[model samples]
Target: MNAPTATLHLLPEVNQREVPAALIEALKARFGDQCSTAQAVREQHGRDESSFEVPPPAAVVFAESTTDVADAVRLASQYDTPVIPFGAGSSLEGHLLAVQGGISLDVSRMNQVLSINADDLTVTVQPGITRKQLNEEIKATGLFFPIDPGADASIGGMTATRASGTNAVRYGTMRENVLALEVVTASGDVIRTGTRAKKSSAGYDLTRLMVGSEGTLGVITEITVRLYPLPEAVSAAICSFPSIEAAVRTTIQTIQLGVPIARVELIDHNTVRMVNAYAKLGLREEPLLLMEFHGSPTSVKEQAETVQEIASEFGGNAFEWASTPEERTRLWTARHNAYFAAVQSRPGCKAISTDTCVPISRLADCLLDSVAETDASGIPYFLVGHVGDGNFHFGYLINPEDPKERETAEALNQKLVMRALKLEGTCTGEHGVGLHKMGFLVDETGAGAVDMMRTIKRALDPKNILNPGKIFAL
Candidate 1:
């Protein structure tokens, strides 16, 4: 119950580890123009969306194929140097930061959709491809990928983090949708797990293991993800509530009664106001729910009617529909930009994002307490959630130069995570344990389980060269 004994200390000074001169020469000879030690490029790969202080890699290797990744890893392994995988560089938990200073395997150039088996409803892609690009490529196939993490993040990054968004309520998270993976182990051995088959009973569930490993065990070079048929009819709507509690209750009931809602998101009053100002939309600034329904026309109507009845019981207003594709895109775009809107509202402030997910039954309690605590803390914050799956985030906007605000935000985040663990839920529903949740991982899973994880890490990567010092301090 007390605050976790561990605490984040001062942002330690970046200790740039020295790369062996021989290794650098070898890399230069092997990669030629593809290898770079340019200060700008290293700095770019050093940080992600997280507010962690930048700790740049010694060099960046723009890999164009799985062979390139394997060779880089093999070379790094030879020298016991850390290798951090880089995709779109949008990771929220400092997953890309060169914490120990090594080589960054930038796979962005590997972007490609290798094959789309329309008959099997599966698509195999190089890890560097982004979700938006994948959807655009396969749009004409009448099949779409459902896992939307709000970021145009690379599929490899999404798999690493086990990301999910609003649509997870009905479709599922990366844990469920990612069918298989081609991983290059720390030893530079290429291996494939799972098949296109709908089910398998072979050996270990290695695919699932790599899906959320956060690149600790191996590098995901290729991914085969399940796809779904585009809905015949789709509708998006926004409903405002007089209070946050009302909005959460509506979501709880809608899910409990099995309304089959495709997506349901909760944006608190402050976030709604920020989005309104940023997106130039005219609407009541109150706690709001953005929902979408996908099915046959009659089924969509029925689901809408059921959800409306549930909403009315909780004082939800009539829905404002975005019936057309363009309208839907615009509305979702604004929702996706909620983080930027919150940050922009605070001018020069940076955001410390908190990802907490609790059981559906306790969603209201967790959120109410969180909102009240942040409100009393006097720190500016915005709230949004994929409430359908009991997952939400609080973007605590603060001037990075102010230590007091930073401390306050971290304290609040710790409390939120502890609360979620108490409710028999996870500290993070989608966001994997990058640098930020290392302590929470120990607290939530206990020392013994984490020890087993370390055992697996050692068995797979004895040198601890793959994304070292990430999920836990080894």
Candidate 2:
């Protein structure tokens, strides 16, 4: 297969638009202490977990309410200034970068559970609430939201990126969980899409249109999402495999058999070593599958038995169960911290993370080839995945000052993405196309579909003032 060219490694062009002085003055007068032009604050809002960096936004507006958001957006719109939304700053794809020199509209202070319709299994919340915070607040209700994207990412950020996680193999992603939204259009007009109702045949599915728009179409102010009742029985287990291929094959078969596994994650031996060093969990050094099942006690047991048989067929070790809540939390926490563990394994290094998802039938084929290529390149990398859903990540640790390392990592990612696309998968399964994946978006969706996206963007955001220079160019 031909390697992706070096152009894919280039950052998006920087074209800083003028943030007029009058606009800043207007925002200050309107928002009072809520608006800030502090250099430090602007810098914090300017970047995310991604490797790319650009000049910080000219100012930062800490919006505390929908009116605050609307007014700030309205003033920026008047100056044709870009307004990039800021959430928990956990995005790995440069989604929060102010590449075109805009003002960062921070909604973190707006976090609140607006309403909870427990009987309806729906809850409406401000976009700023993080997933962990939401779950903690709703625990007493015996219902919880299942889309946990590792990081305690803001609901708005998760919704904007259409994020998924280990639970997605059963619960689905933000695209399916979000039931409604209250959005501020590019014109600073507040509008509502979808409803508390589970199904709708109403006009357009604007909720979906905005769910993964990455803040390009509008600013999500409020989100209503579906929730699930707490499982009567929950069991977590870990099974080691002789090779990544064997673990992946076990996952493929488990999925094919339609086992209702709640969460199934794959961690290579490299990652296991890193996690063991960092968290001191003393996990066995081998490729393993960390899985969980949720259902009635009988059904959960049946699912686990079936999976164990499938895994054993592929030479997987007997299941090691995390029978208690604390044990399960520890194992899952270690899995979630795999990226940080890998980063710390080599100090003074940053990770170029790749999110490539393939079809279940082709998971072993696509993953094995990428693994071989990465190993041959001799790059220090960590591999992990929500393999039950055929989605995975490879975090390549590289020194920031070393251009050569960056190029090598990008090349590896490009090959993986191409392989995934060829296998009828997506370049990104959860992380949306930020500046980093713009080229891949075109490659995967083709120019015509992207042009149609551009058309919709132009029509909805004529000034290109809302999170400009992201998702796609004008």
Give the count of colliding residue pairs in each prediction.
0, 0
How does each model score on lDDT?
Answer: 0.89, 0.92
Report the error of model 2 at residue 158, Å.
Answer: 0.7
Best model number under lDDT? 2
Clashing pairs in 1: none
Q: Report the backbone clash tally of model 1.
A: 0
358 in model 1: Cα distance from truth in Å? Answer: 0.8
Cα-lDDT of candidate 2:
0.92
* TM-score of each model, in listed order: 0.98, 0.98
What would the per-residue lDDT of candidate 2 be over residues 1-474, giving only the tens digit for each residue?
Answer: 233324565577799998899999998999889989999999999878888879999999999999999998899999999999999999999888888997999999999999999999999999999999999999999999999889999999999999999899999999999999999999999999998987999998999999999999999999999999999999999999999999999999999989999999999999999999998888889999999999999999999999999999999995788768998998797799998999999999988999999989999999999999999998999999999999999999999899889989988999899999999999899988988887787778877888999999999999999888887778
lDDT, candidate 2, residue 54? 90
